[model samples]
Each structure stands twice: as C-alpha cells, then as structure tokens.
Target: MTITHRFLQIAAVAMLLGGCTSKPIYNAQENFSSNMGISENQMQRAIVTALHDRQWKIQSVKPGQIEAEITVRGRHHAEVDIPYSPTSFEIRYRSSWGLDYKNGEIHGNYNRWVNRLRDNVLKELSIDPNIEALNNLGAVKRDVESPSYFAFQEGVERATQAGLLDGSIQFYLSGQPVPGSAHHIRTVTSSRKTNGANKSDKDACIWALQSALVALQSAAKKAGANAVIDIASIDQRSLYKDANNYQCNAGTFMASVALRGELVTLK
Candidate 1:
C-alpha cells in the first residue's frame, strides 16, 4: 500500500497495543509575577533558559509568544507554542511527528515531555539570580576548573579543533604591541550572555571573556584580518582598558561581557 496507509496501519497497531491515548492538553497559568514582581522580559528569559536546558530549539519569537520545536533522537518531533505575559503563560500543542496524533489523541510520551518542560520552567522561575548566592559559594580558582571560568588557552584550543579559529591570529589588549606596519580593517565588538545562573562571579566573568574572544576571532576571519588588537572592555558602554584582564558583569541571570577591538592584518 501507500506510505500513508502503511503509517496509519502501524499507528493502528500501536494504538491497539495501548501505546497511545487521549490526554488533556496542558496549559500553564500563574507561572509568573505573582509575588516575585517579575517583568515580562524576566519571564521571557526564564522560559528561554528552561527551553534551552530541555534541548528545545526556539523556532521563532514574537512579542508575546515563542514557538519552539524539540526533536527526540532524530526521529520523533514535537512543536509547542508558548504565549506568555507578565502574570501568566500557556503551553499549547501545535503539532507533532511520529507521535500518531489523531482526534485530539497522541502518544502518551508527548504528555510526559510537556509535563517535564513545565516542571523545568517552574523550577527556573523560582530561582533567585542573586549575586550573593554565588559569592557565598567560595573557592578561589584552583582545585578544579570552575564551570564559571573560561580559560583563554582552552577556548582557543576548542575553536581550533572546531575549525572556526586558528592560533596564527594574534589577540592583544589596548596596551599590547601590534606591528606598526599592520593595516587596520575595522573595529568590532563581541558580546555574549554569561552563564550566571549558578556560577560564581569570577568564573562567569572568565567564561564571558572566552566567549568574546571566540567572537572576535570569527569576525576577524570574516574580515580577512590576521589579528584583533587594542581590545577593551565596553560592557554597558563603560570602557575599561586592561592589559591582562577584561571587564565582565556577572550577577543574577544576566551576566555578560562586551569587547571592542580593532581588526587588522599583519605583514
């Protein structure tokens, strides 16, 4: 028979085996801004983080909604619509593949995935991104590489392995030396969100710096430049020039780092 008929037959057999069933669609309300006084932006961030943690790819984002899709093991796929407000949000079923959805019924696994996503969102919303929490956790560097700190060399190595960057490109701070003969291309800035949820400020700052370096290298390559020079921290529009360290804002859920540098070609 046709592929469609074959699929339907398989689904019918699966249904007969009780692997699929009808379930009420999940809708979450009061998931935000009750006693916490969170804004819509904060609610959006939490939801985004939760989705990322749950391996959901955001398909599109609108002012009041986010469309996301999740693929399980390159076979089953599910899509969801999340329309949110400062006071509430709802997760509605949009579509699915390999789930045998019919007449408002679907494989029981779909319900379980939605339920897990809801639980993660709730947990993320309840977390306090307070800087103090990270500070109290102590331990200065050493012992083990903190998940927060981004080692520069390690970052470079990773980029090289991924074929995105090379060691031939030089990176320098504002006070570092660049060959006087090098031709300046254009100045560029790279900013990245830091993982500040449960990381220490110092570690988060390091990670942000590493992330910025990778961006700069990518930009330089795109511009046919061999180096990024005169790097300066311009986070929040406040410029800080340091030879050995960059500036980072680490606290709460919004840790970030921004670096500006001149892209140049060396002889």
Candidate 2:
C-alpha cells in the first residue's frame, strides 16, 4: 500500500474510535472565485447536473436555491440545500436518518457525500477534464474499511448489463492469452468511482470496476480496437497482474478501481 493509502487507513481507524463517542457534523458554504464570470443560470445548471450525476433527488427548486436529498441502499438518507448565485454556491446539511446523528455530530459518510457534491459542481464549472483527480481532491477521508478486492468476472455481468462492456470487445487479463492475430494499438488506464454509502464492499467494487471497463471500452472503440488485452490493476502506480481478479479500494463513501490495458485489434 502507498503511504497515502496507509495514512488514510490509520486516520479512518481514528475516526472510528472517535465515532464511539461523537463525530462531527458537516456543512459546506463554498465561495467560488474562479467561476465569477459565469452566469447565474450557468451556476444553477452546473449544480443541477452535479446533483443528478450523484443521484441526489431534487426536492425543491426556486430562483436562488434548491433542496435535494439522497437515500442510500434504502437505509441512510441525507438532505442538503444549495443556495447559489453566479459567484458561488453552498451545500448546507439539512437532516439525515440511519446515520447515527446526535448531539450535532453525524456519520463520516455524510461529509464525504456533501464534499463530493461540492467537487462535482466544481468539475461541471471547471475546464479541467481530469475527473479522477477531482474525485481524489474531494474524497480525502477513508472508510473504516479502506480497501477491498474482487475477481474479474465478479463484475462482468453487471458491466454488461450496464452496457459498459460487451462480447464485441473482449477483455483479456494479464497472463490470459490474446486469441487470434492481434495488433496492439495503445496502452491506456481507466480510473472510476462508485458511491459506497450503505453498500457492500463487493457491490461497490463491482460498480466501480464496471465504470473502469467502460472507460477502457471507450478507448478501444476510439482506436478501432476490438479488445483490451493484458489488463492489470495499477492503483497508485503499483501493478497487480492477475488472470482472474482485479483490485478495488473501497471506503465509507466511495469505491475506486483503476486499470491499465493494451488496446488491440484481432485480425
């Protein structure tokens, strides 16, 4: 494990200990100097897009503000209000259920969800296109359970159902033979995230893996390749090659999968 991941794991353990007594309530009122020149309508659209992408249901909408809520795995729920102008927006925590809220403190996952909302808003506004980097900036805290791993096929069905992968584009993992005469097109990496609130680690990992597969599939299609071969986990720059399984890191709020593979066309 990288130092950063190790540090996050240690910090999560500390947070768990603190949670035995009281955690902290999270509220965000962010000012965006960078988006000053944008219009109020644009700000609203950005916020709405971010909210939708994160699966937050819009409760109410008006001229300068909106109320939204999310229920995770039919268990945890959170509500927040976004009051925005052309200059900035705020994600103020409203209420929650099934998250151990008491004496002004709530579950750590609440903060992560809100923070991710904030970052996604920034992403919708910013010109930078590195989503993984933005996600990294937002989800700094780790879950009590920091990491999880799973088999390659464990996520394949879900990925196929989600239209992220298909038999048209085959995925050959490391040490798995590439059938037919295949010409390598390029090597690419995909990193993807899935919300982990109240979800099983395996399920979250699979969702994330599905997204990563989609990214690779997109790249392969773009390069006119029919397959992605020699896939391996390259999280934090360390390679974990396997013919069957891949690696995923699951925390309280998010699960992430990063994969590298060579795009190839079988002739």
Candidate 3:
C-alpha cells in the first residue's frame, strides 16, 4: 500500500477509537426491586414518605403506581415512576436534566437516587415489626417508664444546648428573603452526611443543606442579624470541597452531600 493510504487508514482507526471512548456506558432503564411483605396501603405510605423525605413532589398516585418530580434548586429536574404491589415494588427512571444521557445510558446520579429510594422504602416497611416478641417488648417499655429514661431525656436536652453553642445558622435560597429589610452579612457554609444504608441521597442533600443553613444562621445571629439574604449557587460538591460549596458522594451503601453558601442579612 502507498504510504499516503497507510497514514489515512491509521487516522481513521484513531478517530473511530476516540468516538468510542468519548461516550460512557450507561443503562437505558434503571430499576430497583423490594419484597417487604407489607400490605398495599402500608407500602404506598412508605413510598410516599421516601419521596417526600427527598424533596420529591408527588404529582399523581393511583392503585399500584406513583409519579413524582424532583427539582434541585430550580435547576435540575427529574420525573420518577414507581409501581408496586402488596408485597413488592420497583422504582424506575422516567426522565432527568443536567445529567449525562444517550440512547441507553443515563448519568450515574440517577441510579444512585433510585437506590436510595429503594433503601428508604424498605426501611419504612420494616418500621412495623410483625414479630410478637418484639411487639410485646415495645408495649412493655411504653407501659413502664424507667427513671433512666428521664435521665436520658435530660442528656438529650444538654446535647441540644451544646449544639446551639456550636454557632449554627439558617439560610434562604435566592428570592426567599427574610420578612423585612436586612443587612448583608458575610457568606457562610455548612454540610452533613448520611451513610446511604438508612438514608437516601435526597435525604443526604437535605441534611447537608440544613446543617449548612444552621451554621450560617448561628453566625448571623451572633452578629445580631435576624436572617440571611440573596442565597444563590446551591449545589453538591461532587468533585471539590470548600468553605462555601455543596457536593454529594455515593457508594454501595453510603452517600453524603456537602453544602455551602453566602450569608447575607435582609434589610
């Protein structure tokens, strides 16, 4: 073969390889299955709770099916369809935004969220134990309050007081202003975590944001400020961590989100 032809052939092969590597492999459909031996009514309740806990709004519901929507900071949004029976259920992806997608693949985040939902559903289903012995034990404890229980309660109060001293704060997203005019305070940030075993990614995101808000509010209060203002750029710090940022990570049975934002006062 001519040298020119040989070079052209090599270039074509390289181009083909590049195209293949540029696209990631993803599943066209993602689903989760659970068999908790719960009644249909109970299962539906659990499903709703799982979605609500993650900030998902239930758009519609009927026998053996649920439709929900998830919107992240008015940016990324997703629709999820869940169908279940008396003893089993499945969470399936319907659509999404701000995520990688192709004919058959979706961004990994979608799968993570679904998995978290499944875990939460199972947790809710297990809340009502069917074991007679466990039920009896719980009943006895409820009937007979112990002295140590009061002491434990006191300890909880002390812990709460300590948390307040840690300088926690509340924050508002952009456009969600405090009641009246407020001054602009320094930007503040905070974060929280969930093990993904008992909590979903949505729950982790909420907790992280809540923690950050608490810290921000605490700082503002110390500054004699009543509320924060112009809160913007709410997000998850999937790659980098900083003082004013939000991010989430997931593993087999672990998930966490870090949140950060500017602290401003409403004047």
Candidate 4:
C-alpha cells in the first residue's frame, strides 16, 4: 500500500484501539512536528477559534466590534525571541460565586510559544516577525525552516562530555550585558519547575534550547569549528541531559533548563 494508505490504515487501527496512550501518541507526534507534517497557521487558527468558541460571545471578524485594549506594558526584558513557534493565550473563567454565575473573576493570560502546543491564545498585536509569520501562515502547510535552539543546546552538552567546554551557555547575548549574536531561536518546550508552567512549557523550553544553540554556535565559531551537529530533542534534554532537574532560576519566569550539543569539523 502507498504511504498515505498505510497512514490511513494506521490511523484506523489507532482509532479502533481508542488511540494509543497519550505518551506514545505524543512521542510519535513530536517526531512529526520536529520533522514533518505540521502547520503553524492551522495551529494558530485552531487556537483562536477554540477560544472564541469557549467565550468571546460573538466570534466573527466584525473588526470594530471587538475592543482590543492595546497598551504598552513598559519595556520588559524583551522576552527571548524565537522563530516559527506556536504560542497560547488562556483566559480562566470562574463565577464570582461559582462556575454557574457570570459575576466570577475572569482573567486573560499571555505567553510566548514555539514549535509546540500551548494552552492559550495570544491577542497581542505587537508580535515579532516569527510570531507574525506563524499567524499569517494560514491553514496550508508551508515549507520553512529558520533556526533551532534544541540543536545548539545539544552541541553544548556534547562539548561538555568531550571535555571541550564548561559553564551554562546562554543563547541570547541575554546573560552578557553586551550585544551578543544577533541570531534568534525558537524554544519548543520547558520544565514544570517554572511555577506557572502547565503543559505549555514546551514552547518556552524550545526557546531556551534555541538560545543555548545560538550562543554555542558563536562560541564554536570562535573555537574554529565550522558547525555543530546531532542536537538532541527537547524532551531528551529535559529527561536525560539537564542536571539540576530545572530547579534554578533560569530567568524571570523562564524555566531553568540546561541543554547540550557538539561542534564538528567542517566537511
């Protein structure tokens, strides 16, 4: 049978089995998103629609109908930036008295995300280039690749194992008070140690991983290596490579995640 047919067959089987365990299913999906068959537009649209369906009362694009409170919340640590990653905006609703009442305290959440699933939607219009690309990509799958943080972090880890380097590598010139590399990264996941981190930590973690990668790449270039190779997946880094179990203060609200990778001789 053709690959597509085989896919349908496998899907049918999975449906018959009530779908595989969440763990395996997610594992298989991770392979797919990290490698193939994922759409950023679809992700963003689905998120927006899901939120509209759950609330917002009227859901169409009436333009002037919705009131968007666009305000400058001041210059915050321009939170680490990444490319082509998915983010979330979750609004928790609870009746002031209980779930049945409309007078409850309702609040909205805003988070940065990438290459992974998050539990909220981002209503902020002031998004970076990567985020804008994600929102505008639409329902069709677009062939694109920007940069990977996980890859860089893995390079650092590999370097450590090889006795070539030491110390935490910050991808952003973030740690150093100087303008580090102008490079950008996309974090795909993060650890639960981040107090408010829910299942959505993956997006932040991927950003962190990308940060390390860019930093390491710069370091590697300085070390005379042409490139870094064989970067580990975010899940792998979180499970096996990270030493602190993500307990330290990585940054304000950013999870304390340590990743590793290696530099290779140029081909």
Best by lDDT: 2
List TM-scores for all candidates, in order. Answer: 0.42, 0.48, 0.37, 0.22
CA lDDT of each prediction against the hidden true structure:
0.69, 0.78, 0.52, 0.32
Regions of candidate 1 where Cα sits further than 4 Å from its true position: 1-14, 19-22, 31-33, 127-267
Model 2, residue 90: C-alpha shift (Å)? 37
Off by over 4 Å in 2: 1-146
Error of 2 at 236 (Å): 0.8
Ranking by lDDT: 2, 1, 3, 4
* Best-performing candidate as measured by TM-score: 2
In candidate 4, stretches whose alpha carbon ends up further than 4 angstroms from where it belongs are: 1-199, 232-253
Greater TM-score among 3 and 4 belongs to 3
Model 4 C-alpha lDDT per residue in residues 78-185, reported as the tens digit of each score: 111112233222222211211112222111122211112222332111112232233245211123522223333353465566554544332211122223223223
The digit string of per-residue lDDT tens for model 1 on 1-267 reads: 999999999999976787436565555544432534446886788789889998999998887899999999988898999998777777899999987777777777788888777767755554322322233442222223322323344544555676655676788787877776779997677766566668877667656666777788888889999998887665221356766666655556546666677899988
Error of 2 at 108 (Å): 33
List candidate 3 stretches off by more than 4 Å: 1-37, 127-267
Model 1 lDDT-worst window of ten:
138-147
Candidate 1 structure lDDT: 0.69
> Candidate 2, 46: how far from true, in Å?
32
What ranking emerges by TM-score with the best candidate at the front?
Answer: 2, 1, 3, 4
**Candidate 2 residues 65-159, lDDT tens each?**
99999999999999988999877789988888988888888888888898888878866654222434534554612534444668897687778
What would the per-residue lDDT of candidate 3 be over residues 1-267, giving only the tens digit for each residue?
999999999999986764554333222222223322246887799899988887789999999999998877776677878888775677767777765456756555666666667667754653212221222444212234320111212222343565632333344444443566656655444433334456644453444344445565566777776655544322211113222333343333433333334455544
- What is the Å distance of residue 222 in model 4 from its true position? 0.6
